[model samples]
Target: MTHPPTTAIRHSPDLEGELRAASKVTLIGMVLDAVLGIIKVIGGVFFHSQALLVDGIHSFSDVASDLVVLGVMRVSRQKPDQNHPYGHQRIETIGTMVLGSILIAVGAALAWDNILRLIQGGADQVPGWPVLVAAAASVIGKEWIYRYTRRVGQAIRSDLIIANAWHSRTDAFSSVIVLVSTLGAMGGFIWIDTLAAVVIAGIIIHIGWKFTWDAVKELVDTGLSPEDTEMLKAIARDTEGVRNVHELRSRRMGHDILLDIHLVVRPEISVSEGHQIGMQVVSGMRDALDNIRDINFHIDAENDEEHPPTSEQLPSREGIRNLLDEHLGGLPSHTRIRLHYLRNKIHVELFFESPDDAPGLDAEQITRHLQGYPWFGSLRLWFGAR
Candidate 1:
């Protein structure tokens, strides 16, 4: 199970910078898609090229998706509040899902149109050099936007932007189909134009499915890869007082990671020392991974897996103290006692101050006396100097 980090994790400037970069790139893409889409639709109608017209519709869809990206990026940058402790990173994931669904719907409609056209035979008009020119321009424009948007997306770790980049790249490929089919139609093979539209539809559906499938996986809290989990485990294991590390888990929040782990330390240490070890783990992980927003550390005295709980039939502290006094004359009133229950037995530790001249039973005698009790696990006798 996951727990909150020891410290409140805020969205750092790096994430803000990434969002800024993505927004700017997407805005530029929207402008290019609008202009290119208008050009393709007008030219397609004038030259009677159905393939080019469908490609134009695809470009328009990119414009719509870019608008979604711009809107989501704004809300996703909001700070965490009482209502949403994890901030708004999942907004981007949801935006990606919406974008993918839109792409699929648009592609399905285009495919259905083309399929009906193909079944009814081919259009009579031949596409001229004008249609080919528009397709070529679209390929160049959309591909440039694809590369630029993808670079920005990677820099900011924005999945929505990256998905949109692939959407742009799909447009570029679809334009290539439009260009090829336009050339074939000009050569008197008119049916090829409709067939190319069908091909473009298939490509759109494939890319759309990929984006949707990935977003769904993130929504379900899919963990990091095994290799990444091992890397985090290694970081915790290398901490100063951590003897071992286990139960390490991770989940993604935009570009950042939320982690949960258990740090094993020697059982004899104090609570403060265990906390210090946990701090070491937090610092080590923060230094190792820039995008780690939170880590929950659970300190273990020993491997709980190796030593399960036993039946609780042991005597209470007062009962044990009475047994000690009854067996060994008496314990000093100022004595400090600690009890450790382990492996189905009780280990006793007692501390008291004794002057050099004072007389009392030695450590060996105390151990010998406590050994008679079947429930006794071990004994520690400490007499401090006066």
Candidate 2:
């Protein structure tokens, strides 16, 4: 007998709560980013500060990314459809990629513009007190947002929320750079402001690249970390009645994981018993790993490497029943028969009801009666009836 794979089901309450939390935080981030961007742009133009102007560009990028997060979260929260049986989680990953790539482009553009100004020696002009004030206010505001978003994100374990919080924190760092450079330029170190733009651009580029690489890896169906895989395997092997675990595999879809593995059990167990053991393994693993969304468990009666199914030549259930009727007619009808196909033959087990006594034919006598059949390997009689 061949056992098929089992697929695990995901509960929706956690997912729904995550979506709600992410939406609320991202929306708040969008408002804060928009306000900060407008303030910095106006102040930079008024005070002639190159660093503050580019810092505004960074804040604007945050606004755009927050919008991307919002759009992706909406789609990703949708239930699984006919076209996408795995649900819409991957869309969130693609959204992250889009945001990252856009940030890279924006960073490159800002860097190039500022580098040209420095090469032409046109960025030597000093900024006024208003530019420094705007940068200071931005630093405070962005830091506050970052801390709040990070707290909520970690509580819910939402990648999107956490990523956006990092984005905000990066903006705060850029504002700090702007503040320092503005002060240096006012003190007659005129090139410091232009250099600040380049540094801010580098930070933006690095953050963008990290987000893009992580999303790309997920899109390629990368497995869980080796440590997590080891933990999951240990859980499976510890399951009662599970002799061993093999061929463990895992993949991610957003925050959830999908697993595929084989559980080995005693060769003599009935099919129903094997199924129960597989279920137990699944339950234990689910309790250990909260992110597991589904599992495809394949039950194996023996080490498949040692005993291939195609090599087995065994009597069918009907053939075994007919043999018993023809040769052992006095056996009670209520007796249960179990056949274990192993070593290219059938190992038979007869189970009797409570208070039932042993049959007249012993194991050796039954084996002798079926001696002419090449498919009969061994026989056992179990008389303790329960």
Candidate 3:
């Protein structure tokens, strides 16, 4: 037996609030990026700091990425529809990938420019005091924004928001590089500023690659970490009626998890009983893991994972009843026949009103008659109410 999907765990009001919070943070970052980008570009030009100029462009890239995050977050929070029954969360993953690619391209271009300049002989002039002030201001502003964004991301469990926060933090780091290199240049080592630009480029590329690769892993349906998978298995095993848990599988859809597992139970239990056991497992998993969105549990009479499924060629209930009728000679009226298909054979139980209803109907006689069949397992007869 299989249970239907569970959806009661998700609350729309809470989700809406989270999305609103994420948007507010992104907008704030966007405004900050734009202001800082303009300042660094102007300061780099007037103060003759190439490193500061490249950092300025990096700040503008953050502004563009902020736009991407805001747009994606809006779409990603939409409820599941007929066209997207799993919701639009993967839109956020795709957006994160795009953001990472943008960082890569920007970092590579800036690095190449600095490398070419270094090869042609470094700048002749030192950056002025104003460049240091601009870089310092950016360091403080970007660090503050990074922390604010990260706090919101963790609260909402949003990967895209967290990725954006790291992007902001990178800007702060690049500004720090600018501050150091500008000071070095002022001390007459003009090559330090250009070298610092190359280092900043490397940092941007590294961060971008990390985000992009993580997104790719999600897109490819990577399972949860080993620790999480084991925890889920432990929860299922602890359920009341589950004899064992096998073939448990899990994957993520945005911040939520989806799971399916095969649960072994006593072979003779009623279908409804097995389904109840599955429900308990689902409840346990949800209580333990808040992010679970859906769970599908297959109730099994035995561990079918290590063996082939009960053979389809075996006689079905109808076929078995016909054989019983033919060999046992018209079983008593209102007879109840129960069939257990296990280990490639059938175990039969027949309940009837009374023994006198079928005179001379001995178990040995029936077994002798049916023993010739390849699929016969065993037989038991009940002459009274079952």
Please give the lDDT score for candidate 1.
0.79
Q: What lDDT does model 2 reach?
A: 0.79
- In candidate 1, list every pair of residues with a backbone clash: none
Off by over 4 Å in 1: 1-13, 193-196, 238-240, 279-290, 309-348, 353-377
TM-score, candidate 1, is: 0.80
Error of 1 at 167 (Å): 1.5
Taking all chains together, each candidate's TM-score versus the true structure is 0.80, 0.83, 0.86
Worst 10 contiguous positions by lDDT, candidate 2: 1-10
Model 2, runs deviating above 4 Å: 1-13, 81-85, 122-124, 269-289, 309-316, 322-332, 352-376, 383-386
- Looking at model 3, report the run of 10 residues with the lowest lDDT sum: 1-10
The residue pairs found clashing in candidate 3 are none
Put down candidate 2 lDDT per residue, 79-178, tens digits, no spaces. 8889988788899888777767776776687678768866876455678899888989999999999999988878765566667787888888778878
Kindly list the per-residue Cα lDDT of model 3 for residues 223-300, writing each as its tens digit: 889998899899889999888987788877777787878888887777778878888888888888888887878877
- Deviation of model 3 at 25, angstroms: 1.3
Off by over 4 Å in 3: 1-14, 325-334, 353-362, 365-372, 383-386
Evaluated at residue 365, the lDDT of candidate 1 is: 75
lDDT head-to-head 2 vs 3, winner: 3
* Candidate number of the best lDDT: 3
